[model samples]
Target: MADNQYITIMLQSLHKKEKVLNSIIQINKRQKEELENPSLDPDDFDKTVEEKSELIEQLELLDNGFEKLYEKVREELQTNKELYKDEILQMQGSIRALAEKSMEIQAQEARNKQLMEQKFASVKKQVREIRSSQKVVNQYYKNMMKKGYVEPHFLDNKK
Candidate 1:
């Protein structure tokens, strides 16, 4: 009876962890979109990152709880595999889904990284152009404002 209850609790925990992973995948997709936006909002992207962090922490907690429960019935479950076959199968499916979601997140984040690098390169080019133009303007001003003693020319009115 106790082992069955433990299996049920473990299944519930796995479901919660899988849900969090799915949410994180969605957030990563949203982040990719934000990066692609012409006018990217840093705050929004940062908020999503913060949200992802919290979810990751929740995942850790879920994992710890799940591990503790599994330890309680580890010997029994291992010996009586057929006893809780249905719950075990469901948990396996949840694990597979989590893995798929994790892969999706990695791919999305890789794309987002490329986009961020491109944006940074663009900003760098603009900064360099502005600085170059500023230097040219300063040089022009210096040349125009340069003061020196001018050679005097005496008028000769001898006819």
Candidate 2:
């Protein structure tokens, strides 16, 4: 490809990457909403997790290509800075925008993770409560058995 073509491709890839990042942000927002609900369905949450995983995979693939294209563009800009001064400036602007978006996404994701951790802690507490209740019930049954408690034939009969 020609120098201009390479730069054009890199710019397009950057825009695409930006769009993917935005999608991730939206997905994380949805997840946060779901987590906020009191009756969160496990199945629904699993679906969101799957969707996020797929989006991340795509992002990884895009990054691989983007890196190569970025290196090429950088080399071209360095070698012919005078000739491609305008394009280089444009690329810089796009890069700055991408960095800002990435930072925003990172913040949102961190919030989501914290929410998830809180949820997990809550679930663990409930499980502990349930186990403790079960233990009490079992102990009561064992005591009754030890005392030879048996079924009474009549309501007034004590056995």
Candidate 3:
């Protein structure tokens, strides 16, 4: 069954227990009230006694019923308690696995970012060096042409 369904069933069992306990309490209260003030008239006294006896019998029957119900509920609660424990353990295991996976992913992402940054810095350095070399080569070519050590490429191509 689903977790929520189990929880709902447990709640219903608790509600049943509360109702049964309240009924038992009310019955005891009534019995106490009757005992507190006995009937004085002989005829009324006989009638009261008969009514009390009937009430006692009914109370005995109710007590027996309540005992059986209580036992059943107790057994059910014990079984459910075990089931709850198992479910909690399962949830804990799942959470731990998820946490481990998250940590691994985060670590991998961090390493990848670090590697990317290093590569970018290396590329920038190489670009700066290439630009500087290009400038030096251009200066050398211009000086050679002015000194007549080499003909300008444009003049040679025109010839």
Best by the TM-score measure = 2
User: What tens-digit string does per-residue lDDT give for candidate 1 at 78-154?
Assistant: 89889878888998998888789878878887888898899889879989999999999988887788743356899
lDDT of 3 by residue, 1-159 (tens): 444454444444444444444443444444344333433244653564466456446545644654555454555546677756654454456446545644554564465456546655766898999999999998899787775366457545563
Error of 3 at 89 (Å): 2.9
Q: How many residue pairs clash (N, CA or C atoms closer than 3 angstroms) in each of the candidate models, in the order given?
A: 0, 0, 0
User: Distance from true position, residue 21, model 2, in Å?
Assistant: 0.6
Report how far off residue 104 is in candidate 2 (Å).
0.9
- Please list the C-alpha lDDT of all candidates, in the order they appear: 0.87, 0.86, 0.53
TM-score of each: 0.81, 0.83, 0.37
Which candidate, 1 or 2, has the higher lDDT? 1
Report how far off residue 131 is in candidate 3 (Å). 1.0
Compose the digit string of candidate 2's lDDT tens values, residues 13-124.
7788888888888998999999988799999999999998998898888788878877767777788899988877887888898899889988988998999999999999
Q: How far is candidate 3 from the true structure (C-alpha RMSD, Å)?
A: 35.2
Candidate 1 deviant stretches above 4 angstroms? 147-159
Ranking by lDDT: 1, 2, 3
**C-alpha lDDT (0 to 100) for residue 36 of candidate 1:** 78
In candidate 1, list every pair of residues with a backbone clash. Answer: none
